[model samples]
Target: MPPRTIGEEFTKGLWHENPIFRQLLGMCPTLAVTNAVINGIAMGLATTFVLIFSSIVVSSIKKLIPNQVRIASYIVVIATFVTMADRFLAAFFPLISKDLGPYVPLIVVNCIILGRQEAFSSKNSVGRSFIDALGMSAGFILALLILSSIREILGAGTFLGHQFLGSWFEPWVIMILPPGAFITLGILIALTFVIEHKIKQRR
Candidate 1:
């Protein structure tokens, strides 16, 4: 395989290898906190911060980690970052922190972060790992943004708490519920595949 350029590594996460849409990693926060746009943005940012920092640390220390204990090491690194993120949210953005509940801290075990560490960061140069993590984070954020926007708009007839629809619009309560999230995500995933297929056909 040809070595991937840094730009390719970064851009791939935005669409081709998106953590949520493409890889289907990090579903917990994607579903749980996406009921609102702000929550999704907060969760996405926190996950991104943790992923980027952990990737940099893991790549830098890859040689020192024993093969047998790498998984444990990765968790420790991830958890440390998660704790910082959780505390920071609590301290500054208490409203968003409260809204997110346990989901924010649950990022410690998020598959996307660990998956990248195991599959990419541990084996790649620090620069490449950083780019990969950034790409994955961007992809994750984009997915969350899309999901949250749909949920907030359809479920509440608002965007970011502002009424976007006219008074005649009735909010679809199911859209903000768990089933609604599932349905919306399913449709989005299907749409993504359709777009991909069309692009291939054009080529």
Candidate 2:
């Protein structure tokens, strides 16, 4: 198999293997905390920190870990970074921390993070794993931003807590609820499929 270029490694995560839109990996956080843009951004960054660090650690120590215990080791490495991210958010951004609640700690089990470690990092170079992690993180963040922006705008008539829609706009209270997340995510995923199909046909 040919080695992937750095660009290929990074860009694939943006769309082709996007954790949310494409692979549909991290739905819990994607749906739970994305009613507001700030929460989405905070969750994205925190997840990014854990994913990147865990990938690097897994890549670095892959050879030392026995096959029988590799999965457990990966979880431990991932958990260490998750703890750091959780503590940092709580200490520096109390409100966002409170908003995120258990989701931040839940990063330890996020398939996007663990799947990458198992599928790519364990067998790849540290640098390659880092790039893959970075790409995946960017994709995750972008997904959250798109979902949160639409939700916030229609649900609360605001973007990132700043009102963009005027008095004429009536907020759709349902857009900020659990049903809203499902509805918005479903639409976005459907649109993504249509766009990808069009692009493939054009080729």
Candidate 3:
């Protein structure tokens, strides 16, 4: 691989170092909001917004902060964004915000955001950090979509609330449960590794 450029930093977030499927960070939201497809998308987007803004701010001011207090500063930055995202969702989409519950605010604690700040934003330029954040957000959303699609269709016989299963088909109760989320995500994670491994071998 060539030395990474600015674009690569952001683009890599989408696929290479995806927070969910690639690194398995923020598993709680990955499983919790994924009970329904809509919820999954909402949670993903909310996180994306927070991640992008936080990265931009953190990277921009990286040089100003002392190393000892950097972690605390990052948390404050992340928490601010989380609050903004949470309030926006509640104001515009009360129903979704309600469904997501405190998990929305918990975005502040999501390892993916903090990890990016400590690992990437602390050293990168603002533009690079923006791209990196966007890419990671994309990766997170992709994973959420895959997981939620499976759960929604299987658990409720619906796709984004539209019935896909005919009347004759009964929904699998387990697919909507917390255990189901864990088992399904585990399988998906395993599959992701298997597929990636094969691609690597072929190359």
Candidate 4:
């Protein structure tokens, strides 16, 4: 295999290999906290912090870890950043922290973060790992934003808590529910597949 350019590394996660839309990783937080835009953003940022730092640490120390314990070691590294992110949110952004609840701490087990550490970061250079993590983070955040925005707007007729629709518009109460998450995610995933197919056909 040839070396990947930085642009290729970064852009892949945005679309080609997006964590949610394409890869379908991290569905727990993706579905749970995305009823509101703010919650989605908070989750996205927390996951980003954990993923980036964990990737860098794992990439930097991959050689020292034994294969048998690499998964455990990666968890510890991911948990450390997860703790910091959780603490920071709890200390300052208490409201959002409360809203996110356990999902923030559960970042320790997020497949996207752990998968990158094991698959990409462990074998790649620090710079490449960072880029991969960043791209993946961007993808995750983008997914959350899209899901939350659709949910929030359709469910509450608002964006980021501000009303977008007037009195005539009735919010779909179901959009904020669990079924809504599934429905919205399903549609988005289908759209992504169609878009990718079109792009492929064009080529």
Write down the TM-score for model 4. 0.98
User: Model 4: per-residue lDDT, tens digit, 1-203?
Assistant: 89879999999999999999999999999999999999999999999999999999999999999999999999999999999999999999999999999999999988999999988999999999999999999999999999999999999999999988997989999999999999999999999999999999999
If the candidates were sorted by their lDDT against the true structure, best first, what order would they fall in? 2, 4, 1, 3
lDDT by candidate, in order shown: 0.94, 0.96, 0.92, 0.95
Between candidates 1 and 3, the one scoring higher on TM-score is 1
Q: Write the per-residue lDDT of candidate 3 for residues 1-203, one digit (tens) a residue.
A: 78688777767876668788788899989989899999999999999999999999999999999999999999999999999999999999999999999999999999999999999899988888888888899899989999999999999999999989998879998999998899899998888899889999999
Per-residue CA lDDT of model 2 for 1-203, tens digit only, reads 79889999999999999999999998999999999999999999999999999999999999999999999999999999999999998899999999999999999989999999999999999999999999999999999999999999999999999998999999999999999999999999999999999999999
Instruction: Give the poorly placed runs of model 1, Cα more than 4 Å off.
Output: none
Per model, how many backbone clashes are there? 0, 0, 4, 0
Q: What overall lDDT, based on C-alpha atoms, would model 1 receive against the true structure?
A: 0.94
2 or 3, greater by TM-score: 2
Clashes counted in candidate 4 amount to 0
Per-residue lDDT for 99 in model 4? 93
Model 2 residue 125 distance off true place after TM-score fit, in angstroms: 0.1
Question: Where is model 2 poorest over a 10-residue stretch in terms of lDDT?
Answer: 105-114
CA lDDT for candidate 4: 0.95
